[model samples]
Target chain A: MSTGVKHFIAFAALAIILIALPKVFVSGSAHTMMSLMGIMIIFALSYNILLGQTGLLSFGHAVYYGLAGFCVAHAMNYIAREKIGVPLPFIPLIGAFAGLFFGALFGLISTRRAGTVFSMISLGIGELVASSALILRSFFGGEEGIPTNRTKFPPFFGYKFGPQIEVYYLIAFWCFVCIALMYALTRTPFGRMCNAVRDNPERAEFVGYSTQRVRFIAFVFSAIFAGVAGALATINFELMNSQSLGAGQSGLVLLMTYVGGVGHFIGPIIGGVIITFLQISLSDITKAWMLYFGLMFILVVMFSPGGVAGWLALHQPLLKGGRIFRLIPAYALALVPMAMLAAGLIMTIELAHRMLVDAQSDGSVMKLAGWTVDAAKAQPWMLAIGLLVCGALGLKLAWPKVREAFAAQSAEVAQ
Target chain B: MTPALSLQDVRKNFGPTEIIRGLTLDVMPRERHAIIGPNGAGKSTTFHLISGRIKPSSGSIRLNGAEITGMAPYEINRRGLSRSFQVTNIFPRLSVFENVRCGVLWSLGYRYSFWRFVDKLRDANEKAHAIVEEIGLGARRHAPAGILTYAEQRALEIGVTIAGGADVVMLDEPTAGMSKAETEQAVALIRKISEGRTLVMVEHDMSVVFGLADRISVLVYGQIIASDTPQAIRQNKAVREAYLGEEAH
Candidate 1:
């Protein structure tokens, strides 16, 4: 197939998946989750524009997202009170413009120096806005935050967006458009220059390109997209607050981008969906969900610095040469030990937490996995230690087979 | 005829230590000039000052009779003067072809264009491919520049320097780490690319300097000891005592 046709097919597949998502899940909560995922995907990609493509490390990207959200929320309220004729779907454009305004404003100062200085400046700006949001009651509404009704806007084609499903479709539309534009930007001469600037600013200057200008442009675009994500979020939750612009929000997007892999275009999207899913599902079942997230991030940083996308990309040569089947048995053999290790570790942590922290209310007994185990007894501790030791031994014995199989398959592919 | 580059009493001081002290030289248009010196004699420092990577503590530097003193490197480059580094400074993550294409971008009037796809720019692509072939890295054009052999990286550096179509091209130690055959190939490549363009080079290799330079300047202790034709430079007493010595023979 030609490149054009292939791209068309891929786009069609993506559209189908996005449009069919809410229908397949078919619940109010599912619609809410999908909408959140769409917003996060856009946010992560915008963050990637700086971190991955441009090699900038920003600690306060949520400033744009939250600022844009607040701006759109104010616009929505003003439109409703004065009966402004602007429709609801076009509100993100307001956010985009606001984002661009602040982006250019902040970028002018921060982009003068890159690397550590740039990161520190962004952190300072983020904190400035976040703290100011508390005192600026008229705009930020203090602790209560500003809330607006999306349905107050004039109807678009007789649709007031009264349902969550309609809002999901709106976010999905913006998400796809922003993703397509960001991807197209990467193919342009400007995008190539951004890469050149990122890799070596000194050489980039000798090549007759201003490194600061390239970074400023990328920073602005990244902020604009992040603002769009914030706009969609404002419409979904019907509120904009200080938490939206906080450090925790910035950290969440960074976690998604790095864990997904910063090297590839699709990495942020994968990260956005996975992190959002885990955040929603895991938070319901366990109070230690954040601990799991931190562990996952550390593992990704240590073993797979490229993140999940990088790990998936590593298998491409094997798949191309049809040598993937040769390593299947080794992978399957390794899976059991890995599962055992994870279970043993989780069990130990939960049991220890129960014993030390919850000791007063629960007596010495802990209810876990439909079994009542006495924390004072030695049997459970011995069982946990036994599981941990056996899992480690199994992993030690099985790891070499996986490595040898992988090396042999790689050699075969190389030949 | 106007000189391609002119530096007059150009002195650069880092803190209190003067690196280029009152160094004055003139490079004629379309001539290959070489600056040769011992280690720590500030040959690379001179290149940095001329290229606008660093400013002179005091003095005037001009290109094509236009004052470019204290200008940014990109502004100097926009005025049609380009230089390669002594250390290999090509973008390591970019492919060899991409590295050359980056050099041609500003010259082709594609400054900061975010709308048009680069692959669709036929002229840029053609020029970049021609440069890759000229540098003898056509087969390895798709490989990342970081993984290229040392000689190949040096060749890519020269290719990048000349790709911008600058009127004045400066190279720092183009054959610093090459073997005899590799140095011969590099000299040929440099000579071919510098045709109709004024070339300035800092070289440690005597053979390369003697074979390629039209005129030679001997720099020692941050000052030019002698500036003359290659044969005259080979016979100058001060040049012999300061730099050439037995190597000139």
Candidate 2:
């Protein structure tokens, strides 16, 4: 099939999936989860316009997301208090304009240089704004932040958006639009120039482009989309707090974009969904989830620098030739030991947390992956250590054979 | 006719060190000019100066008698002068067609536009394809530029430099690091592209310089010691003593 047809079909399938998700899941939490996915996807994709598209490494992207959230929150409040005619669905545009204003305001100085200097400026701006969010009590709402009611707006098509489903659809609609536009951007002359400037700014200039201007426009666009995301987020939670624009928020988007992979268009989407899911659900599963997230980020950077998308893209040749199945045995062999190692590590961490952190309150007894373990007991500790050693040995033994299988398939593909 | 490029007493100084000292040069339209000099004679620096990669410490540089001293590189490029680097500078991850298309975009009035799809720009795409074929990289059009052979990349570089339809093209060591066979092919490409266009080059290879340059200038210690025809440069007493004497040995 032609790529255009393929893309259309893929996009249609995604739309269908978005429409079907809430219906199939049939839960308020599921709706909330889906809404978060839409917001995170927009935020991550916007971040990629810098990290992936333009080769900008920004540490302060969350500033746009957060500031835009505040803009939306305040706009919602004014509309509600003044009894204005605006509806809730269009609120994200306020965020978009705020993002654009801030993007233009900040992009001027930051885009003057690329590399370490640009990154430092972003970091500085992030700190500056994040601090301002606290000190500027009137607009930022001080420590409590700004909160607004979505139901306060006039009904659109008789949909007051009091229901989670309605909110999901709104976020999903904006999500689809932002995602499509961002992807379409990659096909434009400006997008090509962004790539050009990213790859070699000097060459870009000689080809009749102001590389600084290209980066500045990209930064503005990125921020606009980020603002849209923040607006959607405000709609989601009915509030915009300092944490919304915090370093943690910015760091989360970076984590999502990187782990999802920064090389491909869909990388950020995958990152947003997966990381959002983990961020929401993993806490319920383990208190040590942040540590796990950190571990995963480190591994992704070191081994799969292209993120999950890169790993998937790397295996396309094998998948096309149906050689993937041949390597499955090698992979399966590694998976067993890898799981054991993961389990052992989890048990050890949980045990340590119980003994060190919660022993005074929750006691030394805990349930881990269906096993009752006492942190005070030596048998469990010995078992955890044994599993660790055995898993390590098994993985070490299995690694070369897996490499051999990969090499063999790669060679065949090359031939 | 006014010279296509005129650098009158151009001088560049880095901190306290003066480079491109009192460099006055002029190239009439459509003339093939080569600047040859020993190492550290500021050959590349001169290219950088005229191309707006760096500003000269003092002097006036004009293209087609229009003063362009200290103008931004993009502005200078828009005024119909384009250049290539001594190093292989290109958008490495982009496809070869995309690389040439980037060169063609601004000149074709598609500057900084995010609205229009590149594939939909018939003028840009066709021009890019034609240039790719002209450079004999038709088969490699879809290949990422980073993966091309060095000779192929140099060919692509020259293609990009001239793709903007610039009437004046400056090349810095375009044939640097090429094997004999590759250099011959590059010379052929250079010759074809420089036809009816002003060509300025900085080259270390004597054979390539002697073969391609209509006129040669010897730059030593940031100053041109001789500016004349190639044969005269080959025989000049002072030129030999100051520069080529060491090479002749």
Give residue B34's error in model 2 in angstroms.
0.6
Q: What is candidate 1's lDDT per residue for A1-415, written digit by digit as tens?
A: 8876887897888889999998799989999999999999999999999999889999999999999999999999999999999888999898898889889999999999999999999999989999999988899999988899999988999889989999999999999899889998998899999889888999999999989999999999999999999999899999999999999899899999999999989999999999999999989876678888999999999989998999889998999999999989999999888888888877787788778777888687977678899878889888888888888999999999999999999998999
Per-residue lDDT value at A127 in model 1: 93
> What CAPRI-style quality would you assign to candidate 2?
high
- What does the lDDT read for residue A116 in candidate 1? 100
User: What would the per-residue lDDT of candidate 2 be over residues B170-214, giving only the tens digit for each residue?
Assistant: 999988999998899899999999999999999999999999999
Candidate 1: stretches off by over 4 Å: A355-364, A374-378, B246-249
Task: Kindly list the per-residue Cα lDDT of model 1 for residues B56-136, writing each as its tens digit.
Answer: 999999999999999999999999999999999999988999999999999999999999999889999999999999999
Interface RMSD of each: 0.5, 0.7
In Å, residue A186's CA in model 1 sits off its true spot by 0.5
lDDT of 2 by residue, A1-415 (tens): 9888998998999899888889898989889988999999999999999999999999999999999999889889899999999988999999999999999999998999999999999999999999988899999999888878999888999999999999999999999999999999999999999999889999999999999999999999999999999999999999899998888988999999999999999999999999989988999898888988998999899989999999999899999988888999999999999988987888788899788888899988888878787889999999889889999999999999999999999999888
Model 2 chain A: weakest 10-residue lDDT segment is: A365-374
What is candidate 1's fraction of native contacts? Answer: 0.88
- Stretches of candidate 2 above 4 Å error? none
